[model samples]
Target: MNQWLIVPVAIPAMIAAVLVLAMRTSMTTQRAISVAATAAQLAAAIGLFVLASDGESRAYFLGHWPAPFGIVLVLDRLSATMLLLTSVVASGVVLAAIREWDTRGRHFHALFQFQLLGINGAFLTGDVFNLFVFFEVLLIASYGLMLHGGGPRRLKAGFHYVAINLIGSTVFLFAVGTIYAVTGTLNMADLAVKVPQVAAGNEALLSAGALLLFTVFAIKSAMVPLHWWLAPTYGSTSPAAAALFALMTKVGAYSIIRVYTLIFGADAGALAGIAQPWILTLAVVTLIMGTIGVLAARSLPDLICYSLIASMGTLLIAVGLASAEGLAAALYYAVQSTVTSSALFLLAGLIARGGEGRAPPLPHGTLVIGLYFLLAIASVGMPPLAGFLGKLLILDAARTSAHIAVAWSAILITSLLLILGFARFGIQTFWNRPRSDGAAVQPLPFALTAVIAGMVAALAALSVFAGPMMDNMTAMAEQLIATQGYIRAVLPPAATAGLVGG
Candidate 1:
């Protein structure tokens, strides 16, 4: 009723556009607007979460047209949860960047706001074309954000980032074009209804389209084979930029769940015989590859980046299993990983500051060492943490679905690789003595530490209340897998209310 969905996406865009003009006159005002805009978006997201928990899903049809003919914005449980997570993490990173903000830059605040606008837009939009538009919007802003300070390394990374994404965009466009060709619509809700009606033989075309689309998403999500770009690009970027990039990949993973479950779920014959099975296979490979990357990487940022790859793999496994519980596990872990991985990267930045312009070498001081151990334990899914709960749910889901071999193997292999990876890094950095000429250990910023601490606390809270959280996530996952709930939420009252309830 409140139309709060629009605020999270549109308010930032409006503020960013105005800031572009105001930036030339008042840098302080621009900074204030940027911070305030993010904070407001965070509040709006929380409101949406409350609405979602009450079983309210809102849909806005652009230009006053109804679904199937016009673009729409739909917010259900999944979207609401993702929006809240994105807002919280984005706010933390933006706040952390306060010390690093460049008041003199022409587009600093403008780009940051626009980047957030794109992210929120992606999370809220109900149309496929709009997703592409938001992705580009985010990427264009990211290009600037990555090179904001204009160093050689940043420039190099930006070039690869832009080039790879340009290719991804092309693939994305091709996939969308094919989907529209077959379904005659780009609205995801509409496509969800129309895609199953496609001819059997033409199913090949749909599969091809889905595969192409998945490829683009896998690249963005940093799935193993397509993940080469992430470490170098993210590793070279500034800490604030890297923190933002950390969450951006989840957008891709989220799309994977959204599209596969909503539009492709009805085509179980096709998906089960080909797409889902292949995805499951890839998930295993991705998990192994990512873990190896972590074990071998010497740099802390690179290790964190590879750890992100591992998390992405874990999510893929859940999605590939295609059960309600599996999806809930994926969603739960997705949130946990986003929070923990970002915190780890921020901590790495803090540690690096204490080094010779690199991540603090292994064997850090006692205080730093303890924190690293805690983070490593969390990242690798040690018991009594949110990560462990998510992993346990995933294993249970896999086992219940009768994929016992894959389930047990995934659990065992992932646990071993994660533990070993972290152990190697922990020993190298914290347990070993500091290098003789390494930079003096600068006091980590309280803001950064506070964020990490908050993430840890959230992880612990989620674990403590795992039962309720799992129940909610299970409900959300059931609705998502059914697709009817989302479609009903997006359609006009006459079309959906009687069928799905208002």
Candidate 2:
């Protein structure tokens, strides 16, 4: 079980190859294998999550290679949490796609598995270079998924998506190269140990590299100004793909949290928190713009896409607080919002009319409407759901920050905007529209409904067990802030000294 750190990546990689090479023509076979692999992944992730709950960081050196030199997968509370989230989302997304979405195009099942491989690898890798490699893996797979249910709109959006990511990839390589050249290592643990000791002459160079790294991550996370690619891309993609993609941005957020805390953390001397100053300010702007986009949206997919951005804004604010409480809050919110975003995207597929531009609402009868309202309330951070609880944690964390007023104002005001946006869309979707006479109304598919209910149920469980979840998150945050534990866990004993020195 200790070696199962690679399960998240290996399971997907192996199955994806099998699906591509052998099961390409058999939809039935592909569906069966893909579903089984995803369930295996979920089970493995759960095992890893329980293992990580002990709070000690563990490293799995690949091919028996030592840390800071060869490939490694490190499992800590954060990585374990993300792995679980990815596996959970993949299970639901695959289930949703099996019915009709995967049949829309060739290789969707393979692409989806590859997407999971990339996402899981991104979360688990201990090397910065491998992180970039996983990023490419996921991005390439996403291109195919984005165009799975092809349309002229998807083609156009996919092109922009590809082009934007290509630029980000190029920047990512440059940043990795710069960091390696300066620090003499690409391993995150090694970098953490070495960053604090950088010579004064190299401080500026390292700072530039660090900031450049954040730039790439910000692009991947869909931060504002760079967020132009998200709405168009997500809105055009199929709902199942879009739902899975909700985890992709978290890859970026996870990278930001990981590198900033471990490598450029408070102990990094001159390089301490190089990316900190930009996070909160940009997060606020991001939330505001996303809120505006949500209100301006004319279609369900488009609206949900913007709302996803707003949720990112809120999540990042907790992250930018640069405190243990903030990290805990951000982690909690990340889980909640990820599920809520997926739920809304799936709901969009069921409820919206099929066509381009300003997709008028198609009545989805009772079940879908009920799910939509439930998700909408959850998405808008209304009470009694995990979304609301996550936001409250964020606000409480922000209370101690010097930027308390700004954080509160931004969160509270944008929350109102989110509610208004969801309300406006909901009224048009469920309330004001008149159903045609003598028209046959199709009931929602039980499978899709069940998949969605599972996600909602996860959110409900988070709310129901909010205390225990937050307690774990707090311990995880403590582990994150105490960088020495990670440094010791990954590196040889002799190497850990002086690297984590504050």
Candidate 3:
């Protein structure tokens, strides 16, 4: 009877369907529905967070069937956190989109709601197969949003994005099939129990399964080599779309934390032996490359995109450490990066709008320049900001895990790159006298400014609450590392190998 677990996923989906009915007749009605749906989702998310804080895990079996045979939805602290973050970001992006609403706004709202549905479902689902379904839901909605205006550039980027993710989804399907074939269950909790029992002789199969799953997640998270599609895709999309994309990438990062720690702990640790070193090495490479990309970038949006890539690498490096502290840092950084990056992207949009949608040939006024400097400093991990706190945590984790050299090197090099890149952007956009064409710039909308300001305030609040936040993260990390907490929450005690009936 604990239906609260289902409300977050179902409300958005139902509202999306309702929007389709009203799409042809009343645009105002559709917009209201969209905003109301997101608000409802936000409310549900807050409620779930309160429930989760009480340390209860709620599981709902579809059709009232039990465990392995039936699909399940599970809610825990991590899922609740993700749902809350997703709702807040989605609501912000939706509200921001209202400033630029077009005739297609109905479709846009529908897609946004559906996308949230996918994201929430992915976080809540107890079945791996359902995760794939939810991922596809997210992708399909994203495809529409990415190409919503249907420009040549967006279409081109959308093509590449969709094609690459489709392939990733195919591989995901194969991995699911393999896991099911070997373990005979797609429920994550069931597989968490069954997978380790895979015959020793068939360890190779399980490893391959794990690796395939890792690859799918890697591409989703935009880890180094698999990150080719991100910069362009984000750069081409609208700021609202880009903000949503920022949250989407974290879903993959969340999966890495959730699945690797919960379901494939021993396998992940073993894979870490082979994979962790390479991930660390590539994390350094990605950090340097992304920083360099930012420095050399011609536009603010591109700079933000590349910065995001670099941040993702940093989080992955934390994940590679496979320690409780490392995981906590990664989680902390994931939340921090999402808020900061999205805010920066919105700032870039505001900048472009101020310049009349064209890049200024030279810098503007000193006041504008000063604001740019502050934002740039914050993005580059200046002290007392959220980024600084996150980077410090990551560096501490890496050092404690004995990756001292890699840790220090990554911190130093990335800091230098960020500073240099932002310096260049600040100089170009603000320091020098504006070109003849740089007449008085228009002010950005109050709503947009308010949203960005709210994000910055939230980040500051997070810093102030760091003590309690880190405590929760540390406890969650301990629970994850122990694994038994998750295992017992998801599966019943009697369930075991080979074809256990639900």
- The candidate maximizing TM-score is 2
TM-score of each: 0.92, 0.97, 0.92
Candidate with the greatest lDDT versus the true structure? 2
Per-candidate alpha-carbon RMSD to the true structure: 2.9, 1.7, 3.3
Candidate 1 local accuracy as lDDT? 0.80
| True-structure lDDT of candidate 2 | 0.89
Q: Which lDDT values do the candidates have, in the order given? A: 0.80, 0.89, 0.78
Candidate 3 C-alpha lDDT tens digits along 303-396: 9888888888888888878888988888888887898888887777666664523345323344345446656766777877777888889888
Displacement of the residue 11 alpha carbon in candidate 3, Å: 1.1
Candidate 2, poorest ten consecutive residues by summed lDDT: 353-362
Local error of candidate 1 at 495, Å?
Answer: 5.8
Better of 1 and 2 by TM-score: 2
Cα error of candidate 1 at position 81, Å: 0.3
Residue 215 Cα positional deviation in candidate 3, in Å, after optimal superposition: 0.7
Question: In model 2, what is the error at residue 44, expressed in angstroms?
Answer: 0.3
**Which ranges in model 2 have alpha carbons more than 4 Å from their true place?**
353-364, 436-438, 499-502
How well does candidate 2 score on lDDT at residue 163?
Answer: 99
How many clashes (backbone atoms < 3 Å, residues ≥3 apart in a chain or on different chains) does model 3 have?
Answer: 0
Query: How well is each residue in 321-428 modelled by candidate 1, as lDDT tens digits?
Result: 888888899999888888888878877866776562334443335656667777788788988788888888888888878676986687678778889988888777
**Candidate 2 C-alpha error for residue 42, in Å:** 0.2
- Model 2: number of backbone collisions: 0
